[model samples]
Target: EAGVTQFPSHSVIEKGQTVTLRCDPISGHDNLYWYRRVMGKEIKFLLHFVKESKQDESGMPNNRFLAERTGGTYSTLKVQPAELEDSGVYFCASNYGQGRAFFGQGTRLTVV
Candidate 1:
């Protein structure tokens, strides 16, 4: 089974710009979740997608952030008009019935 993969590994953008992060989960896994941990903050859930439907997205910080899962394959997270506080490490995880999950190395987004 293939593990989750994230692109770029690191990103630096100016304030008020946009950034898109991608995540490819293990094949056949129906559970994909997005999480992040900002400086001095614990890892926090951003959203979850089961198949093509978004199971939960209550953890999304604000309207500036958007997440989508098309065709139940891979997912993408976009932050529009990024802010300084948006700087953090974004992780994607996939679950396959087991309590353990596979995580990507994460994409570090820094807004200056």
Candidate 2:
């Protein structure tokens, strides 16, 4: 019955640092996704996961990032050697069987 939860609501890291963000969706949801909004731009889809498998990842920016859903429970997005351009608000959402997505407060990443 709880909504999605994302850790570290805000992050500040130096360029080239590695950061991992975690997302825990509602208990019974099977659809999970990561989205981003950069500097006032429109929210962009980053990836989607159906259970433990990545369903769609075309929106992922580059190889510097990695996403995983372990045991089909929680998900994590990791950025290695992060770039300044990666600074943005990262959102996590989930739903049950095609239902409307419930989003977290989002983790604001600042790479300086």
Candidate 3:
């Protein structure tokens, strides 16, 4: 079975533009998370999803960002009006509620 997969490995957009990153986790996993790393800093948790419901999203930077896991199958993170500070590698991970998580090849986002 496939692990986690992220689309459009890289994206470059002008400031105030919008970008959406997608992630498909391994089938049957119930826990999903979105993370970000800016300028080599440690990965910061953005949100967590249990199935199709958002379990936690306090880590999200602001209202300009949105995340969703539809039907508990796949997830998407959208950054509207992208800002320079938002430039970073966005990571997606999933697990069966415990232990090591399976990560996707992060989507590198750059806002010019």
Q: What clash count goes with each model?
A: 0, 0, 0
State the lDDT of candidate 1 residue by residue for 21-50, as single tens digits.
999998888889999999999999999998
Residue ranges of candidate 1 with Cα displaced over 4 Å: none
- Better by TM-score, candidate 3 or 2: 2
Q: Model 1, 14: alpha-carbon shift in Å? A: 0.3
Clashes in model 2: which pairs?
none
lDDT of 2 at 63: 99
Q: Give a tens-digit lDDT track for model 3, residues 37-66.
A: 998699999999999999999999999999
For model 3, the stretches where C-alpha displacement exceeds 4 angstroms are none
- Using TM-score as the yardstick, the better of models 1 and 2 is 2
Go through the candidates in order and give each one's C-alpha lDDT.
Answer: 0.93, 0.97, 0.94
- lDDT by residue for model 2 over 7-106, one digit each (tens)? 9899999999999999999998999999999997999999999999999999999999999999998999999989999999999999989799999999
Q: What is the C-alpha RMSD of each candidate to the true structure, in Å?
A: 1.1, 0.5, 0.8
User: lDDT: which candidate is best?
Assistant: 2
Cα-based TM-score, every candidate: 0.95, 0.98, 0.96
Which residue pairs collide in model 3, if any? none
